[model samples]
Target: MAFSELNLSTELVNAIPNSFASETQIQSLAIPAIVTQRDVLALAQTGSGKTLAYGLGIIERVHATGLQQALVLVPTRELAKQVVDALQPIAAELGHSITVICGGEDVEQQVQRLGDCPEIIVATPGRLLDMIRKQLIDTKRIDMLVLDEVDRLLDMGFWPDVQCIINDLVNRQQTLMFSATLPETLQAKVTKFLNNPLKVTANKINSVVEHIEEKLYLVNKGSKTNVLIKQISEQKWPQVLVFIGARDNADALCKKLNKAGIECEALHGNKDQAQREQVLLAFKQGKVKVLIATDVLARGIHVDALPVVINYELPSDPSVYVHRVGRTARAGKAGLALSLVCHGETAHLEAIRQLTKRALELNQLQEFPVTDKPSTGENKRPKRDKQANRRTNQKTRASQFKGKK
Candidate 1:
């Protein structure tokens, strides 16, 4: 369905493109209620246009009042950037205004931006609270509050900040919370902060995309990297996103992939705002074909024809695996998730399998060795030095001996 059919204010739709289609179920059901001033608890997986769904409503509501009336709280800086980027056009369409405040940016500049009296404030919970404490931003004028990625906010230990923000605006604003899962803690927060919220869930809990083709490659630990290179070469996918588990891993993978002739960049928490913004813009503009990222950078990234997602290393948590693969198969677009499984990671893979409740299809790669040995020419030094290993072994043996004794 089109944005025009939603009965939104013409100015708001004009500010943003009406070409916007209902890409996800939550957007379809919740946008209408939200535009009509209903409190909402929407559950849509990451990368499902949840940002735009709530953004359009917030823009329309604030435009109606001719005052700043909305505050959107996100869990991370990356998400904060994505949310602001999505809403800015809509706000422009309505001749509305917005300001994004997050950590790792200049506080004075944000304070100055607030002086413009923006209609919407998109922020990370802590930064928002900090601004409020400094009396630089007013919650009193906010008429609608949105908690995007509600589950993640709780994960990041933002509950106290969320509560403080909510309490500050309790008198007059409507509250909306969105998450992929609604655990008991989130449920309690919703009850405490939202009054008569309209609940909506699109994908079933702990479920993978029904149409997404999932492939698991069982390769030897040493040969996995070679297998990844081979797959990338063979497919030559238009756009590919790879998920790694740590900042260091993301950097290392990107460097190796780039060295192997793939144009790639890494995104993670360690990047400065400018660097992160540049990398995302580069990826979106197609200057970069592959992006290696930690799951923290996974939630808010939007790309077109991103046909492939490679789990270069399996995620420790299942929810992360869901979010990683979710970068694709968005907007009804068919996509593929290929996980490269190595020997020691089987337990992690098993945990993920149990979490998703689906046995992933395992495939063996041709010409890729599945044995545990490293290639003959490769360095054989232990990841730790001999002395370090000796100390570790001594500790282990001492612990084992003590247990027996």
Candidate 2:
């Protein structure tokens, strides 16, 4: 359906770009209720137009010159910036200022920005909570609150801070919780914050879109880098996002790729906000061909026409598989999600398979095929071969006839 058909204000509808002729499923389901001040619980996969779904609602309810503000709590700094980027232009049109608050930046600078009294605040929960404690920002004026990426909020260790912020924002009239999958832990606790929310399930919680082509490759743990290098070289994909398990690995993989003659960059929590923003900008502008990032940084990133997402290391949670792959195949574009599964990592892949019904079966790379004891990360000789080699060594030593005890 068209944006104009969502029962939004005519002024708001006219502000949207005309190129957006029809709404995504999430937008179609969410915009109407959000505009009418209904608490919405949206369960949709990544890249399902969720940012705009709540953003438009935030815009529709917010008066540019009014004291009523909106607060959006997200799990990562990348997502907070993504939300602001998506809404800032349109908000500027209506004189609604969208402010972003996250760690790794100058607290004084953020304080100055907050002093401008932005009508909308998109922020990571931790930073937002810190500001709340310090009294640098006022949450009491917030009338609408959005909890994005609810499942991972607890994983991020922001549960208490989120709860505290939610309580401090005592004046919230509408609440929206959006996630690809909402775990039971969050479901029960979040109920108290919502007032009879309108639950909307756009898709099965863990299901992936039909457009993403999922591929799994089984390889020895040590051979993952070599195999990834070979794939990138052979395929020559325009852009690739590799999800590594840890910050150190993300850096090591990026270095390995660059040493192999492919331009790459690494992003993780250790990087300050300026550095994170720079790396993300370079990758988005095609200045960097390969971006190796940890789960938190890659989550909720907005990349257009991204053709591939490689799981260098599977995330700990099975549900995260959907978020990682969802980075590709966005906006109905055909994309590929290649998962590099090493021995002992099949359990993670198994969980992903169970979570989603996508046709994913493990295949071995020709050179990096499954080897004996690979699960232990060592290739050991067979027992018979060792015995034969020991006998040959004994014979050779006796022929030498020189023994030193």
Question: In candidate 1, what are the lDDT values of residues 246-328, reduced to their tens digit?
Answer: 89978988888888998789999899888988898898888888888888766656776678999988877667788778878
lDDT of 2 by residue, 1-405 (tens): 688899877788877776566789999999889887889999898888888888888888885224388889899888888899888988888878988999877889999998998988988887888888989887778988899988888677888888888889878888999988776666887777789999998878778977999888988888889999999999999999999889998888888999999889998988888999999999899988899988865568888889999998887788888889999988778999999887678778778877786558888778776783535646666557887577667775554655555
CA lDDT of every candidate: 0.79, 0.85
Best by lDDT: 2
Pairs in steric clash, model 1: 15-93
For all predicted structures, in order, the TM-scores are: 0.86, 0.90
lDDT score of residue 399 within candidate 2: 48
Candidate 2 regions exceeding 4 Å error are 64-67, 374-405
* Model 1 quality (TM-score): 0.86
